[model samples]
Target chain A: MYRQPVSRLWWLKKRTYFVFVMRELSCIFVAWFAVFLMVMVFAIGRGEASYQRFMDWAASPVVVAINIVALAFLVLHTMTWFVLTAHATPIRVGGRRVLAMREARVAGRIVPAATAVRVGGRQVPAAMVIASQYAGLVVVSAFIAWLVLR
Target chain B: MTKRHIEPIVWLLFSAGGVAAAVFLPILILLFGLAIPLGWVRPDYNYLDAVVSHWLTRLVLLGLLVVMLFHSAHRFRYTLHDGLQLRWEVPIAVLSYGGALLGSAAALLIVLTI
Candidate 1:
């Protein structure tokens, strides 16, 4: 058995690998968000004065910029994870695979329908999985917005 | 007790954390990190305070914080291991999971206090 030698800079050797590395690196931003929220929670727990100070700190140009970048990476993380979920877990409806109909022929006429996106041998459509994840994100975000901003 | 036995548990935490962060972190970060801070949206302090003080909110926050920490830990662990090509598995796992545990404990304390 022979194993090919790989370099530590392999991630830099290709665009997709680089993207994968960036995806992995998104964990740092994720951790940062968690810590930031913890700090905010602590401030809120401490009362109005501390919470105001937190807001002021958060408003600083540097913090805002970092957060903007974090937001971008987080979006990437969400997207890649959702796509992976579609590939990894196949959904079943009524003990049958959930599929998005691509096209159906009726009476010698082609009728357009939902696009079918299958992952290898998996029966569930990738589009359906991705769509459901995004829908979930939308609903969750909307609820949070309502809770916070209402 | 054995490393084999611990592997599945760690993976479970990682998956839970990944799902939690993917679904929840984006919106939360957008709100607190960007929207509120950038003045795109204003959050009333009293109302926000009341929301945070709610028992359900505290519970949810605690759960999210714990899982998110674990998720970060697991990913960072692999990033160091395979990405950075580090061979020290024991130390890496210890630090990654240990930090997550500590963060979870702190989150629990903070949320309970709130």
Candidate 2:
């Protein structure tokens, strides 16, 4: 399908690319996040001591490298993901979406800023607003941590 | 679906998933904290292996991967077209769908293998 010319480019700038980079590189976390289970499978397949050794080695510096990579990306992804909540965020259980129209409008603007900032753009209002949303995400995540951890 | 219905559905799934991951993160940390003192959750043991062992966990993993994949797809796709001025629409579409597919596969495989 020959589509019409698009107006903006998302992956071209620093801030915009931050989210893009976060998204593309996020695979590392999903891969490594599941590593424990993967190692478990490996350990179970091999035997007990080998599993223990694997766990130890997995916790080693090199493994930590993998984990740090995984963890950092996970945080990046989480932040990026949470950042989406302001606009793209919805509250739907039983498939009934409860997000109002204004929330949807905000989400529409914010979600693309992740891309907009990348293409040599200046949307300060959008950025500030989104940053505030991130503030909310931090608060919410903290609250969530409190709730979940407690 | 009309625009009203369509957008809400997307945003709803998107928000829900983000919150889900947000919720899961701390829980996972706590799980780790407990597993440490308890000793039964030994690092030597394959906990990841155990998650995949349960069919429910497997499905949950798959759901998380797929939902987030679609959410990201919806995200990255629009950003590329509207924000990135990328002319190549096919690749973006392919990747968006492909990510979901591959994510589903990886999630399922990890589970089934265990």
Which candidate wins on TM-score?
1
Tell me the tens digit of each residue's lDDT in model 2 across A7-55. Answer: 3543455676556755655643443344354444445546557655655
Model 1 global lDDT (CA atoms, 0 to 1): 0.83
Interface RMSD of each: 7.7, 7.4
**What TM-score, over all chains together, does every model reach?**
0.87, 0.50
Tens digit of per-residue lDDT, candidate 1, span A32-123: 99999999999998999999899899999999999989999999999999887776565554444343534434223343322333444435
Worst ten in a row by lDDT for model 1 chain B: B1-10
Candidate 2 scores an fnat of 0.14
Model 1, B42-97: lDDT tens digits are 88998999999999999999888888898899889878877877779889889988
**Which lDDT tens digits does candidate 2 get at residues B1-114?**
123445555655544455444444433433332333234354424543454456775576557655655555555666565555566877876776566567556656655665
Candidate 1 segments exceeding 4 Å error: A1-5, A96-122
Question: Which residue pairs collide, candidate 1?
Answer: none
